[model samples]
Target chain A: MPEFEPKIVAFCCRYCAYTAADLAGSMRLQYSPNIRVVEMPCSGTIEHGLILNAFEKGVDGVYIAGCNLGDCHFLKGNVRAIKRVAAVKKILDEIGLGGQRLEFFHIPASEGTKFAKVANEMTERIRQLGPSPLNKNAAGNAQKEGGQTV
Target chain B: MIVAQQKPISEIAQMISDCKKVLFLGCAGCVTVCLSGGEKETDVLASAIRIKRTLENNPLEATTFTCTRQCDPEYIAGIDNLVKDVDAIVSLACGVGVQYLAERFMDKWVVPAMDTKFAGGSVVHGLWEEKCGLCGECILHRTGGICPIIRCSKSILNGPCGGSQYGKCEINKDIDCAWQLIYDRMKALGKLDKLMEIQPLKDWSKSRDGGPRKSIREDVMIDE
Candidate 1:
């Protein structure tokens, strides 16, 4: 049997994690290719519906990376993001999707090495957890249609 | 305003487990103000149900719609077209809204997503406290704008019950004795003499004990 590779979606704040991702590329840091990044103006802009939408679209794991605590460019955007992430985690847990599948991290823009590290860490963590139950059938269908597993 | 809290997702999921498709109706009224049943809550609930049913292989198709105020007939009338297509409805409104919607669409199943809590206001963002007892009477003027009917654990109208100690209710130490609040307010307003005036026996007929009640304004009635 071929190894299962999980699909992970990361909502990265433009002020921090997005810049960190760019810096990681320039620094030639190696990271897993499975992470798909959606750049947002601020972490506070990541709504509960957007995270749920990602799960609905068959993503195995979701993470929000934003500026470190007390370091947000918008004063309290990261604080709001933390609360939103906690709220979404509770909903995910209640819906039978383990809360472990979702994560929130504080990262500085200069942490290019840390950005690559999180990508590989999240990819590995999700791979161990396997695919989201919501995506089980969809993954099967995709393999049947595309003649390959994503 | 009416305050409410959402029922657990597990209980909600169980209520509509037999349903393949459901419409989550949100109210932009009291429930919205209390942060329980509103547009954001409606979307969150729809997504949660979709995820739960999908994992179970039952695959629920959930749709969401937010009305101006579910308790108002005019607002609910606007969603009649959407209601006809769904098998069941999960109304995210106060008890009044849920019953109103159910009565309006007698043939369809309408279930409440929120548990109507009380007539209250927010103490702060994300926190609400009961303030009114809906006793069908107003006595705030005599009590220095503090209500003893609901705020008092024992509903004592005359004075603080013997159970009050250190200005806290005996029922819960966290709760302040309503009479204490009234006394303080009365003192601040120089209306301490009002407490000496005996209150008359409350007319129970004006409240829920009088059975289902209605208020009609003859001037607003339309001739047949």
Candidate 2:
């Protein structure tokens, strides 16, 4: 069986995680290239769909990196984002994806180093967890039980 | 506003067994504001159904649309042109809209995609709690806008019962003691003295008990 490289989607808050990623770039920080970052204005503005959509599209792991609590550029945007992340975590559990696959991290604009660290850490973690059960060639089933798209 | 939550996609798919032509209807009023049956949810359901069909080899034809307000006769009339084609119409409105659809189109099978929770408003974003019991009574004037009937776990008209510990309900520590909230609000509003005003047991006879309830206003009625 060929080993699968898990596809990880990270929803990054534009003011915090995204900018921090840009900073990591300027500093030439090397991290896992598997993570595809989707930038949103504020973590709070990300409807639950974006996270679910990633998993629905067969992404092995999804993470939401938001502004540090109380530092949300839009007042309580990060707080709302936290709640939404928590909600999606439950949905992932319901859809046969073990809850651990989805992660929510709080990152401040100043924490470029932490962002790089998260990328490395998440990559290692997902490597150990293996591919999503819904992945086409994943071991558990030749295809999903119902072959449901999401 | 009437709030509802979408049924899990798996359950909704199971409900339409053998049905290929499905109509996904959304309400743009209360359910939209609450994020249940809005355009986003409509799209989500449509996508979920489409994906399931592709995987299961189930031939599915879904026509997605949303109305201004499912509960309003005028808004419902807007869908007259669409309902004629689908095998079943999945309404994303509350109980009212489901029945309204059935009444308007008795020949078409109508299924509810969302469950009506209660007459609650958002506490934060996504979290909702019942605020009005709509017992056909108004006690806000006396309670300082806090509803003891719906907020309190016991629906205690007069309370903060001994079960409350540190202002949290015994039922669930996460839930705020409704009586505690009411007491605090009334105290802050300088209406603590109002607690002494006893409220008689609610008259259920005038509520939804006897039959279908109705309200009439002689002043507002038009007479030929």
Candidate 3:
């Protein structure tokens, strides 16, 4: 059997983690290639529905990278992100998806090394946890056709 | 406003486990203001249920719709087409919305996603506290704008009962003694003398004791 490689999604705030990812690339840092980075205006804008959407789409793990407390460029966006992450974590646990599959971290723009480190760490954690239970069957693929809005 | 909280995701999932497709209906009225049921919430619930069902290998097809207000028949009429194909409905409004959907779609299985809590206003961004008991009467003027009926531990007509201590109810230190609040307000307004009068027994018949009540405004009625 081929070694399991976990698929992860990272939601990064433009002013912080997103820039840090760019810097990591500039520095030639090698991190796990399993991640898909999504840049957002602010981490606070990340919604519970979006995180759940990722899980429903069959991602093995998801994480939100935001600015440090009191360091948010928008003043309180990072703070709001932290609270929202906590809320979604609880919701994930309430569903069969363990909250361990989701994470939130503070990564400032200057921390390229930290960004690479977190990327590898999250990838390793997910690898050990294996694929999310939602991905156990091929049915999960068909379920991703997404919900309709009426 | 009416306050409500969503039921646990597991409970909602269990309610519709027998079905393969469902509609998550949200209300834009009180439940939306209270953050329990709204468009955003409806989407989150749909996603969560889909993920849960997928894990169980049962899979699920979930759709979402948010109406202006679920309690009114006029707003519910908008979803007639949407409900035609779904196996079940999960209403995220207060209990009223759940019953409205049930009454409208007699053949479809309908369920509540929130537990209607009380008549209250938000005290903070995310915290809500009950303010009104819905006793079918209004006595705020006589009570100096504080409602002892709902705030008091015992709903005492005239009181700080013998249990009040440090302006807090004996039942729970966290609760303010409603009569004490009324007294303070009355004193500040120089209406303390009003509390000195012996109060009359409340007419219980005007409240829930009168059974389910209704109000009709003849001027607004459209004769059929």
Candidate 4:
């Protein structure tokens, strides 16, 4: 048997989180490779349906990284994203999907190290939670992908 | 406009638990303006149900159709073919739409997804408050546009009632006494003299007390 490695999908805003990801790469920062980043023009564009669809697609964890409060390129986009994230969290909780599986972070464009930290933290938390109940083959597949080490 | 709110997902899930295929009908009428039952709400509800059923291993097949207005026969007739294919239907319209759908498609199982609240308008982005009682009477002229029938906690006509104090009703401080509002408005309009004239007893025959009501326009009727 092999270890389980959770898949994570991160929606990053172009003005901040995306730039931080670029800086993290240029600075030779080491972060978990399990994260798959989707770039958005603004965090406000991230709708509640899109987050749920990602979970339905079998991702173990999902998060939205947007500009810090009052720092959004489009004035109040980050604030709107914050409220939307809260709404999605409540829906997730109602549908028996634990709300902890989704998260939102306010990150400035200068915080490359913080971006790397969030990736590692989310990876660790999801690893502890194991495979998502929505993913029936997730555990067996994770073992297969990790190779025979256990 | 009529206001409504969606039922809890657990109750809705239980209603169609036995069914494999279900159709979610959305209304583009009063429920749409109230933000309770519309195209967006229908999609959200369908997605939630799909996720719940998928997790339970039942894997429901849900489809959505939003009609122009469910209260009218013409709009409901447009979905005759789709309604024939589903085992059950979840209507996201006001109470009127739910009944209309059931009446039009006699054989299909139709259930309501929202609780018809009141005749009101939005006070803010997501909040709504009742403003009318639909008592089959029009007396806004005498009451200064504040409806004692609905807004008043006690529905006392020509009264401050013993419960009114400091412009608020005693039932709940958050609620303003309707008579007080009427009095203030009438004072501003220099119509305080109108309050001295006694109003006649209300005619209950015109209200719900008269039983189920209907409005007919014989001039617009077409012989079939």
> Per-residue alpha-carbon lDDT of model 4 for A63-149, expressed as tens digits?
999998889899989888888889878877888877888899987889999899999899888889887787656766575542122
Supply candidate 3's per-residue lDDT for A101: 90
Evaluated against the true structure, the overall lDDT of model 2 is: 0.79
TM-score of model 3 (CA atoms): 0.94
lDDT of 3 by residue, B104-130 (tens): 999999999999999999999999999
> Would you list the clashing residue pairs of candidate 2?
none
Q: Can you rank all candidates by DockQ, best first?
A: 1, 3, 4, 2
Per lDDT, the best of the predicted structures is 3
In model 1, which regions exceed 4 Å deviation?
A136-150
In angstroms, how far off is A4's CA in candidate 1?
A: 1.5
Per-model TM-score versus the true fold:
0.94, 0.69, 0.94, 0.93
Model 2 spans with C-alpha error above 4 angstroms: A110-113, A124-150, B3-10, B42-63, B81-85, B120-205, B215-224
- What value does the lDDT take at residue B85 in candidate 2? 83
DockQ of 1: 0.83
- Model 3 segments more than 4 A misplaced: A136-150
How well is each residue in A25-144 modelled by candidate 2, as lDDT tens digits? 888998877688888888888777676666666777888899887788999988887887787676555544667888889877788898999987887788789877545544432233
Q: Each prediction's Cα RMSD?
A: 2.4, 6.3, 4.1, 2.8
Alpha carbon RMSD to native, model 2: 6.3
Better of 3 and 4 by DockQ: 3
Instruction: Output the worst ten-in-a-row residue range by lDDT, candidate 1 chain B.
Output: B153-162
Computed on C-alphas against the true complex, the DockQ of each candidate is: 0.83, 0.14, 0.75, 0.55
3 versus 4: better TM-score goes to: 3
